[model samples]
Target: MSSSSLTVQGLAKRYGEFVALAPTSLDVPAGEFLTLLGPSGSGKTTLLSLIAGLASPDEGAVRIGGADVTYRPPYERDLGMVFQNYALFPHMTIEDNIAFPLKMRKVGTAEAKARAAEALEMVRLPHVAKRFPRELSGGQQQRIALARCLVYRPSIILMDEPLGALDKKLREQMQLEIKRIHRELATTIIYVTHDQEEAMTMSDRICLMNAGQIEQLGAPGDLYFRPRTVFVADFLGESNLLPARVTAATGDTLDITLAGDAGTAQAIASGAVLAAGAQVTVMVRPQNVVVRSAVEGSGKLKGKLADVMVTGSLTKLYLDALAPGLPQLVAAYPTRSLSDEHRIGDLLELDWQAADAVAIADAKGH
Candidate 1:
């Protein structure tokens, strides 16, 4: 199968005065897996609906393969959509459900049967073709939904939290299966999810949205390692946001002093614009912060260990606030590397490489 490209220009949707989406624009290249990620009420679903022709955009245009499809209906758009619920007809056999789309398009019985069989084989559910939806497990039912979508060979696929109902193990298993299908078919997929780990694991790029705006768009690593805004940093993963006063700025690097810790650290400025004496936020990932015993060369901050939480592979250590009116600093260390003798109330030092932190324009809260 060949891949299809999609583009949206200034897409906007509204229900009277309640704007569901606002002036959103995106260009999805052929054969790419793009995920629209956000919290609830962030317009991700509205954007997906607009693109799939389920909802009309009040402004801007939607194009598929360079042809205008802004006013096309869902069926006419030739795109497959998988919703959170499996949406399979409980009364129909799996084979019939898979062939329903082909039937709607007036495909011959023989050809439709052949295509439905192929779709079931593609999803590794050929054995369940004769079973009803109620007779199958949730994972199997979801596979049937996927087969139904593939039977018609749609140009693009839009998924709306398709695995949200499954348990953790099943969700992870489906993530790999969907990724494999995308690779084998070279299909352009636009996926929507509120799960950060799912988005990071499945997509070639992530479009992070907040309050009807695209906060940041980049590869998973880029969004995690080099967040351009405070919201992106906090939303993407766990980060230690330290308030700092910029003492000096040179090119793309800034020398800043931590407000409460009374320590200096150099961080790469996210954008081109930077001025001296500006209050910036220093974003340090929890894993990057090293918790170590006092050593001759390591930078040390005198703080008592406030709490420790051990989960599977890592131990999260919370340190007492070093500065007045500051939140407790947190650091995560691999469980294997942690010393067994350490306990709460033990004084420890935290240090990290200057280059590991990111400097961004200060915002109210994360």
Candidate 2:
């Protein structure tokens, strides 16, 4: 259960002329949880398949625990895999299904049964071992599928959206369960999912892919707080992008004039390079922008509240800039912060700290 380090160099895959994955390179540390996150047709699954030995890479090499496994077949690779569909055998009892992998490896019946029982218990499904897949609920069946993969005690586990079939509450519960299992087993896990929140909550690091290429790879907080590319900023979470021109540059901080309705807002350069007079995009999170009734100080722009959408925990206020050329903006405030005096169409000043604002090159395209 200890061997979990994986490394890929220039991995590429193709189906005829259409490339499934480009030259992708990534390193996953042992006993760490790494998630491949992207939208559909973004090569997340293809990368997982390449790692699992289900599909061959046309270029590059795959190494597990410092050993080359690029050309190895799935069986020879000795990795456990859980698919989105669960892939349980309906005809077999849960116990037997969990024992199948051990049987394939030629383990004795008594030993296989003991291991199967332990695996079932690991996933909290010991009582359902005698039941058939058809008799179990979707979540229970998925647990069985997990048990089957765990019985062999493979060092590396590849899960392809394993909880995608479950309902929202069940999916959240399973996310915690899987994270706990990863911590307890200390196995190297490569998970694939299109859900950003799921990846952010469970993974130690996330590899975001786009159009057969790796867009960015980093810790969830790093990706969220300091994105390198425009696509990463837009895809990972909600952002209010305002056009700006750099007025001054002092080291990492920059004084910029915001374009459109909101007259001018100061921002700091979050990226590696920035020069004075450069056109940039000011990246501001909704939570970072503050809404106030009175203009307390400078760097505040007046805006009219266009709409307010109240969710249980927070309220989202859409504002139209009072200035002629400024763009409309959205701000999210905690429910507790709302006062009885505020109403729709009221004028409010929107302001944000320079440090909270991220400035990126304007030429970077999506």
Best by TM-score: 1
Candidate 2 lands at a TM-score of 0.94
Show where candidate 2 strays beyond 4 Å: 294-299, 323-327, 337-341, 364-366
| lDDT (CA) per prediction | 0.87, 0.86
Q: Write the per-residue lDDT of candidate 2 for residues 39-123, one digit (tens) a residue.
A: 9999999999999998889999999988899999988776899988988888999999999999999999999999999998899
lDDT of 1 by residue, 79-193 (tens): 9999889988888999999999999999999999999999999999889888899999888888889889988998899999999999999999899999999999999999999
Show the colliding residue pairs in model 2. 260-325, 260-326, 261-325, 261-326, 262-326
Candidate 1, superposed: residue stretches over 4 Å from native: 294-302, 337-339, 363-366
Global lDDT for candidate 2? 0.86
Clash count, predicted structure 2: 5
What root-mean-square deviation over C-alphas does model 2 reach? 2.1
